[model samples]
Target: MLPFPSSSSSVMASSYPTRFCFNRECPDFNRHECYRPGWRLRNGDFADLCSRCASAYEQGKFCDIFHQRASGWRCCESCGKRIHCGCIVSASAFMLLDAGGIECLTCARKKVSVGPNFRPPPSFLYQSPIAEKFNDMSLDWSSSARSYRPPNLSGPSILQYNLHNRGDGYEFNQPTSRDKATAYSTEKQRGMNDLMGKLMSVNSNNHSSSILYNQKPGPNCKVPTCPNVNAYQPLISLKEGPLGTQRAFPVTTPIETNGHLGLDERYLWHKANSSPLSHLHNDLNSVAPLESKNLNFGIHLDTPGKYQVVPRYCPKVPYKNQVLQNLSNESVSVVTPLFEKILSVSDAGRVGRMVLPKKCAEAFLPQISQTDGVPLTVHDSTGKEWTFQFRFWFNNNSRMYFLEGVTPCIQSMQLQAGDTVIFSRVDPEKKLIMGFRKASVAQSSDQETGLNNNRESSTNGDAEPIDKHPPTEKKKSSMTTTRSKRQKVEKGDLSELKLTWEEAQGFILPPPNLTPSITTIEGIEFEEYEDAPVIGKPNTGLGSTYSANGRLSAEQDDEEAKDEAEGLLTSPKSTSKHPRHRNGCTCIVCIQSPSGASPKHGRRCSCTVCDTVRRRRETLLLRKKKQQIEIENKARKELESPNSDEELRQSANNSGTTSKNHEQRHAPPSKAQIDLNFQPERDEESLSPSNTTTKDKSPHHDETSCKPPSSSSVHSRHHHHKLHVDFADS
Candidate 1:
């Protein structure tokens, strides 16, 4: 007979006169015969079965004999042997694989070789000495508990919590199933009632209470009740009752059990307030192995709201030194500064080499007599170790040290040029630690001041004498003071500097009246200014535009002023063509008549603007005449040559025609040419006042006139005379 008679069992005993085998397929299922307890049920009572079925269950072959044709049969991934998965009896026979599919215990043990970190499941904790051989294999008992479900049952899934005899006493397995959440409330209530009844009976009479407790052991006395229950005294006796039935009783004082089981006033308080497994479940995977030498457990189960059993494999308590070291490393705090250097473009580039200062390397680093220095181990701020080739090269009869293979470290920190890296040494170990400071906007001014100070100290042979023990804050303040002094000196120099009007005028010039000629040099057209540059003050506000860098600010102001002056001179209206002139109006024409006036200026008009325009036109025409004279000379030379062929005469004629066309395209009209349109009698005017002839008749002109004036030459004489006057004036 069981210790605790469930409600259903009591009702059945009262209603039915006889009992039958629990298995429907048994031959004696409905017969009034002796039966034995088989598997545990959801109601926390054992199923009564005949001797035959009970014998098979004890031998772990009940599923093979009775449930052979059940639906949930699966083949082992390794052995190809079928295992019944639909029932709870064979739950521990297989293990689930991470890749999907199941592996039998034999195959699983062969694959997952146990290591020092492997932990046996809770089921193996209470197994006998014979089961110790299997300790090398770890099983996922929780997965098996989750996968098992009673066949054809609509109630909640059955949780398998096995009990194994360890020679001295029977020990309950740890409840690995997380599904206990569904029955926790009911289980807790039932456990409390049983505990109260036991306590009341024990208070009444100790010997009688022990007997009643042994006769009616609690069904809710699961593994989670008292984790260390076996440590104090065995809760169940190995001695058998009548018909070889096992009886469980509190071998020690029941009061001690209440304390260990956490069912006293404190336990009730914790139960109502907090859950024991809340934090444990979250940190389950992070728990370290109990065999670790560095592992420490600081948790105390006696604390309020901490009734949960802390496993041996809980998270380790970190040491004080380790915690402090971790914090310092994360913050990148340097203990002692050996030397520091700002990374140049080459050092930060993919070249993967860092140049070290000669003085600092000789003073702090190991003495390397050889050019190919030793491989040095360096630790970064994060305590990550790196190997760098510390070599030296000869330069200008001196040795220059370099650290090769620093590209990985530099890239890991995302450092670039202008960033400062500090070489530091920590005490005790005297290990070299490398730290870095990223370049920021505020550091730009400080960098220049620091460089100047370093140079001065190096020259005075006092670089090694500076205080090395000052805190970082003191060093920062000193750097700031130096920067401020440098800035003040620069400001004082700018405030005292002044420039006169003439001195300032030398920096900029007014736009000239003559249009710049375009000249192509190397496929780029440059505006060639031929006239004398006009010196004048710019309209830009130079006084307000002055900055800390006075020279650069002044240059910027000069450029701005030149652009504004040029914009005022080259107005769109001035560049546009006027009805009077053949080409676009000149700057002088626009200046004399700001409005769109069209009355032509006479050749005798001698205003300064008119004179400048006339001289410019004459210069252009003279250049054209010179070019024509050169081309005629070349043609004459070619035609007079003794070896001249017919092709040479034709080429001379072609060259003459081309020169005439080019002159017509580029030559500007003269005052006389403009006047001839209004007064036709002026066409016969002579170019030279010495000859009072109707025209300055050249040999070419005479030849052209005798030809009866072809349509193309009708205005050739007038055009040539016009070009000559324009060229001379220019």
Candidate 2:
């Protein structure tokens, strides 16, 4: 009833046919009810069943629905198990095709012996051991070398042009399991082993037999029968006498000719061509062999080698620079300068040879061994390395070590005399490195000329005249009007003319060229105004005077005044009012108050400004009291141990006081005391006599006056007494 025939058609068309459910647990087992036209049949079994019956089958859902289709299925021959069609793609993958039949990879691996003709499983195609492929070929040097065969390019390729070509054999194509293992082995491979064994067994007794066997012509090789060919056939062959012994030729001229010789060519050739026992004469000769000619070498001025000794000299003599005298590294450095010798004419003439100074060799060169050469490397300024050996020879008579091999190094660096060479050993294992600083050619020439000129001048007794007052040539010409120039009479130098300001001003002269004119010149001017004022002119605008721009000048002055006022407020004398404080610009107290009156005017106002002033005054008074206390303490200390000057003054004061008391007690009485009564005013004078003496002892400049000490002195003494009169006064 379906467009496509049922999968059971192929099974039913066979002689033996029975429809059954492919599913194991189908209830209608082996019955036609579960076997629909769409049901698949495989291996004489129904692989597909009806959906209703399939539900009852145990593995109905899990079974491969396409297993019964021939195109979608394959059977692994060795295992007798069905494989998906895709899994059986290549004959080499999981299966092998043999003369017997196809076999799975597992069966093939177990039953098959891998040989030169064997094909590996597909998985092992890339994993085959490298050693196995060449196992049959000779690898040992003796055998492989003798039997090694090069690929024959003239031979036929795998692509057969003619039908007779057997290129499809295992050598080119994938070999089959039925192919003999020895089929891929070459004759050369088998012969190589036999040849190696023969060579190993070949001794004096059978050596000739082995040689003759190796030289035998093969079927594949063409015959060449010349005497030389027979002697050297198979590459290394020997010719022998009739008795099968090597024949040796007589000693002749040496092989290397033209005055150069070592081994004799004829002797070696004959020795190789004949057996060792073969000799031209049967009896050994009694005469000894002649000695070889002594080799003679030609002398060369310069050898063409990696390094050569071409004596050369510098173009100019070297000069010592501050680098040597002051360079810190030079002082303690083991690697120092070579020598101070100037490049001589002889040294300069030779191209590559540089004659180093003897001192240079001793100072810089390391201790020499018996070889007398120390390897050294010179690192140039550009960082290229040139290697050389510092060879030194001991001069027994001179007792000095002379350095050699410096010539090549110097030539390579292109060093001249003035170019200083410095050596250093930055690495212990590495050779000493040499660095050179080329002297400035121009500077050196200039120095030489200067020396010559100095010498010539000294000889000629010539001296350059020195001007005591060198005239100063002005670079910039100051431009001014004729009037200003005429008026530019030099003001007397302030340092030379010590005069008062008025006297100096009086000495200034009026410009004679000055003339009042209403007209002005039409010229470029720096000032914005048409009429620019002179230097110190009074600025009429804003009633401000200016030396330059009036506004800037006025602002600067205001700022300065403000700063002064602030300073005064914080100064020691806070009571002293600043001139700018009354200006109303900087008085914050007055600016914020109700009355806004200046505190400097001495007017009392019931405002916060007045209150602030009162508080400031109180603080000022307290500070003053602290300062006064400090001053009093300082004075007490001074009075305790007075200086010589103060002690003298105090002694004079004491003497004067005693003299006055004596005179008062004796007869001299003042007019007021005389009138009061002759009774001495001792009681009144006694009460404060100590205070008077103390006051007199205080520092006073005017000691010449008869008047009592000044108020300052009295006040000083008052503080001093207050300190001493402690608890009693309290």
Candidate 3:
């Protein structure tokens, strides 16, 4: 702005300077220079660093070069190699230890490679200062307070230890309780102090010594005490050495101990009160043990004035942590079981409504004064949330609660009638959770039977049993009586007859050659047979032979009858071979009795065979009439044509000769003959006198002189003659 610049200088000034080195500790960090790429950052961009710093980073000495003076520095217990735990660069290079140190990744891998059966030396397992004090207190209590039976607690007391890292030291937030009484008297306190002095003296020689204590005790306490036992304070100070400058490391102790040990019970008091970051230590400890006994943090006295480490069951460091975590999550998700109901047909039906008990609805579901109700969100066992309408319907002067829109959930779980649905609520949020249980097949079947019985009893009042005997006895008696009656019937005992009406009627046929006399009885016409009534064999269409019971006994007989009937109806041999015969043949020769024992029916009889025969005759007569009319039409068309007189005379002579021959053959003209002769008379009337004279003078005047008839005319004549013969025979 102070001076005008050249084009090149202006362009150079507008461009940005080369990025500075990403390492803040580098000597050239603020210098303007070209940068080389270092490690990739979380946003996927390479860190801009000067050449020297980039080279050191690639060599894997970035943390050592830059963070050498960081506070989180610890020596590995196994390899004795120093590791920087303060920065993310070396975060994956080391693992935290349960006692109070860090282990290099190399040593950790080596320890894990030693396999599950490997047990660490007793020196490696060190008890924390707090745990050591408790151990001393437990020893004193066991010796002096043997008869001091504390309150019979229903469950283990949970001690909350909340560790948070602040500026130089860690802050422990422990929950304080006021109801607990002082655990020790003056003598007990003096004994605890002496025991602690001895423990400190024994652990002072170890370089990795760590101690934690509270600077302030409860308002009633008189001696130094651990933060969790008899008294609690807001802040617990951790002292690692004489100068008390070292930071306190997280140490996990066994949660369960012998209930007889008064002070040992404090170990079970710790809850899940630690920060999320502290869980990493727990995860490492639980995973390191594999199959060996857990690395418990406690000291045991093997001999006088000598302390050694002993392995104990640590609940937090066991392999069942994952299982316990899952159980805890489940417990949190479903806190209280509100109510359960077996699904009815309507509950699981397509209607998508579930009926809830009145008390459960009022107590568990939200209060609803309106019928429209409120939309409720419910979580299933699978953790999927679903929204449903919770409403009530007024019924029987009371209210009935119903949950609607549950069909999708029911279908997803594949639940049906007779399955049980459980309703539960989460604790803090009171979230509604729906769960289901499938009903066993046996139980469902029994319920169905009960429902059927109840319906029957409700519909019709209960009926008393006719027999006084027990059900089994009654069943046996009825079966035996039926068997005896059947035997009697088979032996032809008419008094013990047990037959259906159809079967009984089939056995009584009308007397042959005798007519029934009709009489009026109470305005009803009855047919009475004068001759003795004859009992005939039952007609099952199988055969005349009967069993001892006079009934068709074998299934084979019915099968044979069916096969025969099918063959008669469908077989080609059943059809008539005569050309004149039509379909649906009902001739006397074709009709047969079902049992082959009845006589042929007469023509006048009003039976199926007679009716069929009459229909056939009428059909044939109609066909003949049509044929005659057709012939007359042809003759008229011939007459209308301008044919020669000789041709006309020839046609007239042929017609007259044919008529005379038919009359001679059938002296008394039959119905078909009469019909044939009518067409000839019409032809005779159509011919004029000139045409007759021409015909007389023609050469074909004799009866056999006419030209040979056409094949169609011959067929017509033969059909007429056959019809005449059939009529005469009938």
Candidate 4:
């Protein structure tokens, strides 16, 4: 049975009913489960499910089950965070482990150093073999924010608190199936109807439910390819925005005066007085498992308003590291050094001002629109309950955990005028991340990636605060080192995370093709004759053209070559085209010479690439023929020679031929003619007196004794004789 509001007004009631849940309609609600004689149910006490879930909750009695979640607590043992639960935890598992002496599902352990200055809380009730919880509300959570050696705080969590801050309502909880269909109808009212097909995600729109990254989308999200992927980026300058400060794009005057947003002191104080509860959530492990039907309980601060709604089901994934990453959403929002101020006012009359959202005049599907489906207004209960949507915005909704201090200066560590924080929303709705943060440290390496290059002296906005104390040595539960474990916890499953709204910029509308009426190359720029002057040469200074990060600066490249450029338009003056002049024709010698007068004989005018290819092919073919004939002759000699058997045996030893065998196999023969008289065939013209052999000597490089052309300059004629002679000689 789920816990319900006590007959008492306050959520944290001391005495709870034993037998049954107060909500009579609930099917599983127990009636007389914990009927202790001394039970006193009150309005301020936690009311239902006390008697239903446990008499004593012994070991293994549905121990791994997760129950609903709650908010508003104190410091983490690893990271200095104040929240109800440290991170995502399993209720059933916590109970089971408590009985088994292992309280933390996360594989971590700690030892607190007892100093006179270091005092344990007076009401130290929560403790397990792994983690000890603080019961006293007076304990300053900020002091424990890792200031000591081996700072006793949980590492950064992967939880995100419900910024909507509604209690037990759709404003804070995930939406139900009924809510989704209802939201379907209102989809027509949105500005982006093109994006409003049937969008669905694993998680509903609410902060109470923790979500891990899931690879699927909601049932209604559009299926079009991302419009931002392949197209030219919007010509907006990455450098020209409001630098070193974090302010959204609605213009306003400088600080001190009541700014254009009208964020005055009156509104700030009213918010503090309104909600008695400081709602909190974690992103790291606070996510509820998807299959489990556990309800997550966060402080829905709108006690005076109408009923808020949240999703009926939220799934949990692991945590993620934030310092080194950003969601691949629409143009990644550059982290401004100064955090932007966003205020969530549920009561329009109470705040007394209207926020003017610039009409989404342009077309880029950023998550936020003028409507309520965005983080500014998530219908906690799966979009079913429309009126009870939770409104969220960036720094406007900060959990107590985000306020950890550099103690001794705890009082001085209030959020000042120029503080900023960046956040990513993961909404698979399967897991309930209470509030998790990935620790990030600033480094020069970030500069090379073109990430946050415009950031100034105060870089903390661009970088997340790293864990002040990284754990040393191995943890007991097969957990990696502290940093690695924390990193894994923070980087939740992304496959499950789907964009509720997206406008992809990658697609480019193709241009229509047209046939040319005339063909010409008159305005081209290539050759430089006497009539035309050479303009720009390729610059050899690779360094000035690029940064160390390998990003070539197109602007710099253009500046260096500006003198040589020409344009057909009047704006950019066109330069004279390189002149193409004809040269007079010459004889074969002139053509063959470097002057290139005649194409017939000039090497310069010939197709050098084709000539090289033909020569290579001819050489390869000749080599193949010669090798084949040598093999045949060698085989025949082995069959006839008397010494062949002994030679073969000797060659077989040593796993190869000996020097003598190699000499016989590869040696060129000396010219041998034993008879004084030569028998001459008609083919052997040199031997016939009637046909005399004439030798003409020409001086040439020893290496390049190209075949004596058949007395012709043609390449084909020179190789033909070589081929015929080799074949005949063989």
Maximum-lDDT candidate: 1
Cα lDDT tens digits, model 1, 515-539, are 4454333333333332112111122
Q: TM-scores across all candidates?
A: 0.22, 0.15, 0.19, 0.21
Candidates sorted on TM-score, descending = 1, 4, 3, 2
Q: For candidate 4, lDDT tens digit of each residue in 471-547?
A: 22223222333332222222111101111111000000000121112111222111111110001111211101000
lDDT of each: 0.34, 0.25, 0.33, 0.20
Model 2, which residues run further than 4 Å from truth?
1-341, 346-351, 369-371, 399-403, 417-420, 424-431, 437-440, 443-730
Evaluate model 4: give its lDDT: 0.20
Better of 1 and 3 by lDDT: 1
Model 2: weakest 10-residue lDDT segment is 297-306
Q: What is the RMSD of candidate 3?
A: 39.2
Any runs in candidate 4 off by more than 4 Å, and if so which?
1-28, 33-47, 50-52, 56-62, 65-133, 136-449, 452-730
lDDT of 3 by residue, 1-730 (tens): 1110011111222233534455656765646355555543212234455678767766667767886754344566677676644332443355434232446656765664543222221111111111122232222322331111111110111011111111112221211211011222233334333432332242223211111121112233332223322211111112231122221212222111221112232222111232222332322111112221211110010000010011100101001101111354443221333445656556766789988765445434544545766676777767788877777898886679888898998887656544556554442233566665444322222221111223221233332111111123344433432322222122221111223334333333222333545433333333333221212223212111110011111222444433332222222222222111123333232233423234445568876555544544454365446445654755786778856555544443322223343222222223332221121221232222222212121111122321221111111111111110011100
The model with the greater TM-score, 1 or 2, is: 1
Q: Residue pairs in steric clash, candidate 2?
A: 246-274, 246-275, 310-352, 310-353, 311-350, 311-353, 312-347, 312-353, 313-347, 313-348
Each candidate's clash count: 7, 10, 1, 136
- Which of the predicted structures, 3 or 4, would earn the higher TM-score when compared with the native? 4
lDDT of model 2 at position 277 = 19
